[model samples]
Target: MPRNRQILLDNRPHGEASTTNFRLIAEDTPPLRDGQVLVRHHFLSLDPYMRGRMNEGKSYAQPQPLGQVMIGGTVGEVVESRHPKYQPGDKVQGMGGWQEYSVVDAGQPGALRKVDTTHVPISHYLGAVGMPGVTAWYGLVKIIDPKPGQTVVVSAASGAVGSAVGVLAKARGARAVGVAGGPAKCRYVTDELGFDACVDYKQHRDATSLAGALKEACPGGVDGYFENVGGLVLDAVMLRANAFARIAMCGMIAGYEGHPIPMQHPQLILTNRMRVEGFIVSEHLEVWPDALKELGELVGSGKLRPRETIARGLESAPEAFLGMLRGRNFGKQLVQLV
Candidate 1:
């Protein structure tokens, strides 16, 4: 039997998740039964949702079971398969967890799907053409449905979902404006991603400053917003939004860690008649097919450029994940495991 290495959630963190909360387990993998595929993970995705999974609370998704394999999406290659459908060397994607290998049960519906890495990179199955891409698509197309000449504001604009939101909005002929942390990220959000403007939030910590920057960027008033950061930025956006503005509340990174974040102007949600909706991407599987096709075409045509901060080796998953929590990485954060 070949030994399999896995990362388990050792303990729930006190405030922020630390490497201390994760344990690496090395054990021999048992033989696969019928309808089983031995998948060797090549890349593991570290997303903000994982932070919520680390907490013990009421959430859209179940809290990650304690002292178990840490849950995550993985892009892998099927090295061995007992299932009639799967074959060796078939590139696959699944909820393969944070491990070097996973024995996926093919009997379970949607357990895995074959990936085409010839034109599209396999790592993208975890990013641009994957969950984050579809997340942006759903929020943009279904929720905030912006029109040409309208202004769409995006928070955490340098990140995976936010970047995608800005680009797709621009592609749809909407004027896209971004709110990012630093000058460099803001530059990338505008210069590289082709957003109309990017407000560097770190430069303006106070409401007055943030509002002023947003005003300068969106002179006509914000018509739509794709929220990802969700603290003071949400407050600013709400205050600046036009009448009947629509906002898609994605991830609230500010409150992800057990911390108190005050929203200065939540009252605008009612006064402006804004349509604010929160969504969990996993719940809406119906739109993935169309969304993925559009995302793939966008990425394939070199129109959508999704950046990633790649960390080598499975051992780096913990540190890389922690770094992402602190806003240390730009775009999507992924760990490559061979």
Candidate 2:
């Protein structure tokens, strides 16, 4: 039997998660069942949503119970297999979590995808080619629904989901405007990704003053908004949206630390007849093929680029996770375990 190192829930966070709220442990693996596969993690995807799971409160995904292995997305290689469908040495993507190894049932809902990394990095399967990619695709096409010549805006513009929205919007003939934290991210959004404009939110005197900068960036008024950080940022964008504007409400990284939700100008929504809708990409999985095909085509043609911040080793997951929440990462945050 082999020993697996895993991170487990120790305490529920009050607001932002802390290192003390988790525990590291070593466990001996049991004999593989007839229909199971032993997987050694190669990479772990650290995302903003994991912070919600650290709390005992309700959320889109179930909360991680005390003493259970912390939940997350994993890209792993099969070390042993009792299932006929999977063979040893094959790669997969699934919710194997923050651990060195995982014993997964072949028919489980979170099965890993077999990938070939000759053309691209395998970590992408957990990033732009996987869940984050899917999330960006669905959120933009389905939720925001930017039309040709429309002014499209994305918050957290340098991130996986936000950056994808900007690129896709531009490709679809919409004017893409990105809002990021600093000059570096702003330059990446406009110069690198070809956004029409980018507003450096970090340079604003305060979140309250972001609306002025955002208004200047979108003189035509925003038609489609791909939201990532909520609270003040959302309020700012909401104030600048044109009549009949559309908003795709994704993760609210800003408010994840339990900040008070800012009050919005509700009268503008009524007068402008704008629409704000929230969606989970998982709920729209059936529509992914079309979006994925388009995104893949863009990637293949070198139009869309995905940047990733890699943290080596599983033990680095904690710091990587914290860094994402703090906006210290340039792109999708991943912990490479292999």
List per-candidate RMSD values in Å. 1.0, 1.6
Best by TM-score: 1
Q: TM-score per candidate, in order?
A: 0.98, 0.95
Query: What's the lDDT of the predicted structure labeled candidate 1?
Result: 0.91
Per-residue lDDT of 181-242 in model 1, one digit per residue for the tens? 88889889988889999998888778877898899999999999998988788888887899
Model 2 residue 120 lDDT? 55
Weakest 10 consecutive residues of candidate 1 by summed lDDT: 200-209
- What TM-score, to 2 decimals, does candidate 1 have? 0.98
Winning candidate number (lDDT) = 1
Per model, how many backbone clashes are there? 0, 2
List runs of model 2 lying over 4 Å from the truth: none
**Which residue segments of model 1 deviate by more than 4 Å?**
none
